[model samples]
Target: MVANGHHWDPKYPEYEGKFTGKFLHSHDFKGVTNEWKGKDILVIGAGNSACDVAVESARVANSVKLSMRSPQWFFPKFLFGMPSDVFAAKTPNWIPSIIKQFALS
Candidate 1:
């Protein structure tokens, strides 16, 4: 069976009701536009989408802020010489699990 895990509904913060400024969901974000220029932006969450939004917003927005409930460790796109995901994909399955763990560490 195939399963699609995407969530359609956005989980907004409790304080969303009290805020009066412009608010948008990541699901609805198209790209940086003229309206976004010089506007202060606040991106919530620490997931891939949130990071992408914050990075893009910083380019055009006057200021960009990221808020996360907990700390998250971020890794560079490249590990050693190649892309981190590519490195993982190229690893031979025959390699011992312990060796793979050590190398990743």
Candidate 2:
């Protein structure tokens, strides 16, 4: 068993008492495979992680569906809620004055 991407050994005398459980992503769920290239698919778990996978799959697959346990709470990075993730990274100085004004105000 491994946790946090670290491999553990049961035989290690130093680790006489340690807890570990297998971690799984959406792909690990049964009946979900990479071969769904042109088939309708429903993916579960859509808080934040699942939405990403579902959107990508929809691009290639015939259709992609998501089954979420609860509503999602999402926030967009923006200047006054306008597109900004790309502009912020590429053009940092373009909005420096506005950012400073917003910060001060």
Candidate 3:
């Protein structure tokens, strides 16, 4: 099994220097603050961290935009009243991927 920790360095986009607006990595994000209250924000990924940041920023930012290269499957925190992770953990591995996808849909 592959095991990776969460302390990896943030990867910057190639256009980092081209754009003049404020840019920051999700890894460096602390939380929403008054400084973000009226600024336009652009989040660059579709992962959990990006989603969290976008949601939080929307609460205070004048506008928040999420940009991703492609679409992704988004699962809610809860499924059938149980935590989604717990539900996935309890599912038998014998189930086929197609069936799982259908069920989730």
Candidate 4:
């Protein structure tokens, strides 16, 4: 295995190249122009990074779809002017899990 754990996703190796057209990773678009304008896009995950790509791609692509094997808990990019993850990290551990889930829901 790669030391960084950045190997290919094993879940769908066979499904790879089963489609035509551009297939890009989220990191490819960071700080770049929307070069895929007027194209159809299919983002293959729904994690925060993938969601960012889908949202950005949707602005120019003819159609955009996010593929996920399961639903995920989506969080806002910012809350009260702080990154959501930073805000979440400041949450007190003593708080009940139920309350946290409820508030996020």
lDDT of each: 0.75, 0.50, 0.76, 0.63
lDDT of 4 by residue, 1-105 (tens): 001113244233335445655545554455325676787777777766667777777787788787777877777778768887887798799999898776665
**Root-mean-square deviation of every model:** 6.4, 11.2, 6.0, 5.5
Model 1's alpha-carbon lDDT is 0.75
Error of model 3, residue 100, in angstroms: 12
* TM-score of candidate 2 on Cα atoms, chains taken together: 0.40
lDDT of 3 by residue, 24-83 (tens): 777788889898999988788887788888888999899988778788877777777898
User: Candidate 3 — which residues are off by over 4 angstroms?
Assistant: 1-7, 79-82, 85-105
Native-referenced Cα lDDT, model 2: 0.50
Q: Candidate 2: deviation at residue 31, Å?
A: 16
Question: Model 1 over residues 38-62: C-alpha lDDT tens digits?
Answer: 9988887777778888888889999
Predicted structure 1: clash tally: 0
What's the C-alpha lDDT at position 27 in model 2? 37
Q: Number of clashes in model 4?
A: 0
After TM-score superposition, what is the CA distance of residue 65 in candidate 3 from its true location, in Å?
1.4
